[model samples]
Target: MEIKLCSLIALLGFLTIANAQTVFDITKCGATPNSDITAILTKTWTDACASPTGATIVIPAGTYKCGVVEFKGPCKGPITFQVDGTLQAPTSPDGDSWITFCSFENLAVTGTGTFDGMGSAIYGKQKSKAVVTSNGVQILDTKIGTGDDCISVGDGMEQLTVERVTCGPGHGISIGSLGQYAGEMPVKGIFVRNCTLVNTQNGVRIKSWPDQEANDVSDIHFEDIVLDNVDNPIIVDQMYCPSNLCKSKGASKVTISNVSFKNIRGTCKLPEAITMTCSSAHPCTNVEMCDIDIKCTTGPAKAVCTNVKPVITGIMNPPGC
Candidate 1:
């Protein structure tokens, strides 16, 4: 009876090993701890995603110098890229984004890691630290900094949640600058909560193109966020023409609606604490704010509103409209 029991136990252990999920450590696939591992990472990702059951690609703890790390897939099953180390972007990445997740489904990027975009080296040239275009995506407990937006969400993303993340020394979290390209898709159903922004240009911004209408972004929520000396604490910029480049002299093309900001308190680096400039042709609707408070260092914080109105309640500093 003892021998039979031992055999059964060994069989169960072997089965567990066989059925367990796979974890692909990048180190095993020619990724050095302190080198530019872009090519190695690409190969590792391809191998891991080829598994019959989805796998976890682990970026272990070290500073990995890389350029243009993009993971693209309609992967076989749910996939996870667990970053337990720092991903360092080159001074000149030769691309707009440092890291990109394109066309993925059910992807989760979670871990206590840092993504350094080397912003100061290439200020105003780099676009963003990370750009994500995926469905059922969750980005949690990560730190990001870049010259442009810390995290930019692309179109056609659904069921997205960004929580407990910190951003700084860059443009804050943004959605849109949408409606700029042909076949542009709408982004909806986003929830951003428990995030902190420090020393950033803009915080919690939603922007669209100047003219050429036909994209819609709706059903957004930003709650329980802390901002430390951010330039624009809360902004909805419809006339999002940089360097005065919009020649049409028309309102923005994108339509924004059903947005809410709740329990946000912080300091504004600029005098304009809150700015909501929507389009006259396609104004923003159903905007709501609660427990919003931010003060400027130079003067009394003020809000700049045009072409839209918001329902305000409880402790608005610059005062929303």
Candidate 2:
């Protein structure tokens, strides 16, 4: 989806807002519990987005089924999607994204709601990728579980902040599987802090494809994170090729710089707690780590480094490279 010239704020779990005008409740638009509310939600959003002044769209408490839907607009005024109900997706895959928000001026999706993707029913059979391609986005106070990255920072993203999130049963927060296509925009100014990750495949990662177009990734930070039994807790793999599908051509041309990881303490499932395998052609620069204390479940934790030398200080448990 496309979101332009807007602050796309996602406040998950529970929210309370005062002075909300023009309330568009989905139930009033013909939605009932445990039934398909796609049309109702669409109508509600349409009405809300057309309001002369700011409007609020609410999905009240209950279980509801929904299909692939997109909320698109350069809205007339600021819009708030307040979901307090559970929105369950279909068992079968329909589209790339179950719900998408595109091209808004000011939008906030906040709630004590749940989006059940039903990942268990079709985990490995299909691809479930959540890509963020926007600017000025904030994901706060959220709990996420999935088969892929809990939050995947994609191209063209700037000034994004993810805070107070609990992630598990999935890959941790990541920036890029980038450089896969030509002419991808640069990603910068990403901040992820105060999060807890449990049983994740990886934690706080940056991965890009090898032998691709040159795009820059910089000014990334991950801080005050707690990981429990996570694998590859802190990693940066520029040669990211899943399933061995792509042949080795040359090193990634993606420039990675000014990255930092601080106050990260956790237990890793694997021995290699920190891995930084940067591109030989465009080596990562100005990388820093401080106050990291990760312990391995099987043995003493260790770090493996290649191509990039990081500045390290403060309470390194496994020792730095």
Candidate 3:
């Protein structure tokens, strides 16, 4: 077919020129709003925009303070850390993963900015955290406050998109405890839809079961959301993890296939708003819930629905966790 349409138009012009390299203008990197990125990439972007196939460093706004910021391979435009202000890190004596993303691609640290990992300016609890490795990611409308899990996804990541984000007071977005059995392409196409969590502890967490040989965190999806007073709003802890705080434990055997929680609306101080655990070697498959609405300050507001096939009907409070 004409050489397969000329090799799909030269692989879509080499992935649109590998996402269009470089662009940093954090107000010319001498930014104010309290600047001092401790040499944010040797003073504003590109100490190395890593090029085997990577580079897109552009931040336009103000407010600074940085640590452990890394991304490699496949980038064009959206490495944009564009916001109006704030991007911090430093505490826990200094740094662990203030912002350490891995094998990156198409990152968009959106506006309304603020990545303050002051993490209570660290004092232990292994000094708060951060880490998102290898993948095609897009984190939009950012405002993540970390002392822990304000975002952590590793092990050969895949398509990830945590859009319209807003997690405060830590430990919210997670994708693995891929410890103990060690690595692979575990985290798959994960989509955390329009998010919002305040006073957090565990707003939206999807993990592989506690170590054995944790498998694939398959095609998962979390829909339109909002939660306040969070303390375990939506979780899949899997059982015993973070190895009491990431010493790189284990747990995950893939297969959390096509999971979905659609039209989610919430409120949680946790009397069990949403809690999912599917393991038995990667169990929870093709799970779905539509129009879920939850509100809890007390209890009984949970309306569980398990492996629901064709039996879901405009659910209001149909939770069967």
TM-score of 2: 0.88
Instruction: State TM-scores per candidate.
Output: 0.88, 0.88, 0.31
Candidate 3 per-residue lDDT, tens place, 190-211, comes to 7889898887888777665455
lDDT-wise, the better of 1 and 3 is 1
Q: What are the Cα lDDT values of the candidates?
A: 0.80, 0.82, 0.60
For model 3, the run of ten residues with the poorest summed lDDT = 7-16
Candidate 1 lDDT over residue span 255-285, tens digit each: 8999999999989889888889999998899
Clash count list over all predictions: 1, 1, 26
What C-alpha lDDT, on a 0 to 100 scale, does residue 143 get in candidate 1? 81
- Residue-wise C-alpha lDDT for candidate 2, range 142-252, written one tens digit per residue: 889999988888887777778888999889999988888888889999999999999999999999999877899999999999999998899999999888855576899
Per-residue lDDT, model 1, residue 30, is 54
Q: Which ten residues in a row have the lowest lDDT in candidate 2?
A: 1-10
Pairs that collide, model 2: 2-103
Q: Please identify model 3 stretches exceeding 4 Å from their true place.
A: 1-44, 48-85, 88-155, 158-166, 169-171, 174-184, 188-204, 207-215, 218-228, 231-234, 237-267, 270-274, 277-296, 300-321
